[model samples]
Target: MHWGYTSIGASTYKGFDVSYTDLIGTFGINFNLFNNDVVRYYSGFRLGLIWRETTPFPAVGGALGFDIKLSKFYSKIQFYLGMRLWTDYREDQKNHFYGDSSGYKRGLITNNALLQENGAIVLSMSW
Candidate 1:
């Protein structure tokens, strides 16, 4: 059992304002819930701050989600998943077309290609 804090967020379409923020207080337990494996299951209560182009103020909301991890000696592959359901966050929000001066704008858009939205499936995989 442990108490911890973690945050994951994405920038607005303009790449200026913060489009979404997920700051969660997590209570997790590590056990062999599935097998004799090291798996940690997490449940979180969270505070969310969101910025939209049309709204006067950043939308405030609450989010609920679970995170699961499977690590260590899985033959060769290491797998981790971080998927959350949020409120007032835009997952399908499109950014404005910025001028490509030095390919900087193009690079920024492609970096971390995860949809910053509420309740949308954002998948992350790494080796």
Candidate 2:
């Protein structure tokens, strides 16, 4: 499981403040490609959900990385470095108004897009 927070803002959108809090949980199967007393390499596929705001988007991805043993007495302790790539669908809503004689008009605009080429660096411990 992974959890993170992100904040984004633009000077052009003075009155608009955009931020995101994300929580992600994944389950997958991994296989070891190389294994030794000091190091190991593995690869895996993952299926998960990314929760942003009130909606949860389905995500699919793969990971590849290696781990280095930190101590012989504590074999469960390992340093890990990995990379992941995933894709998901996201929808967002925006409010817009146009100039008119009837004052400001409000319209709900929904933006939908397929988000791809999303990558994250994984630096963590293995137990």
Return the TM-score for candidate 2, rounded to 2 decimals.
0.44
Candidate achieving the largest lDDT: 2
Alpha-carbon runs more than 4 Å astray in model 2: 1-16, 34-74, 93-112
Off by over 4 Å in 1: 14-56, 74-79, 89-117, 122-127
Which digits, one per residue and each the tens of the lDDT, describe model 1 over residues 20-100?
333323232323355533333334444334434443323333455544455555544556565555434223233432233
Clashing residue pairs, backbone N/CA/C < 3 A, model 1:
90-117, 91-117
Give one clash count per candidate, in the order shown: 2, 0
Candidate 2 least-lDDT 10 residues? 1-10
- Writing each residue's lDDT as its tens digit, candidate 2 over 18-118 gives 43334344444444444444544544454545434455555554444444545567565566665555443333222212123243223233122333335
Name the best candidate (by TM-score).
Answer: 2
Given candidate 1, what's the lDDT at residue 9?
56
TM-scores for every candidate against the unseen true structure: 0.37, 0.44
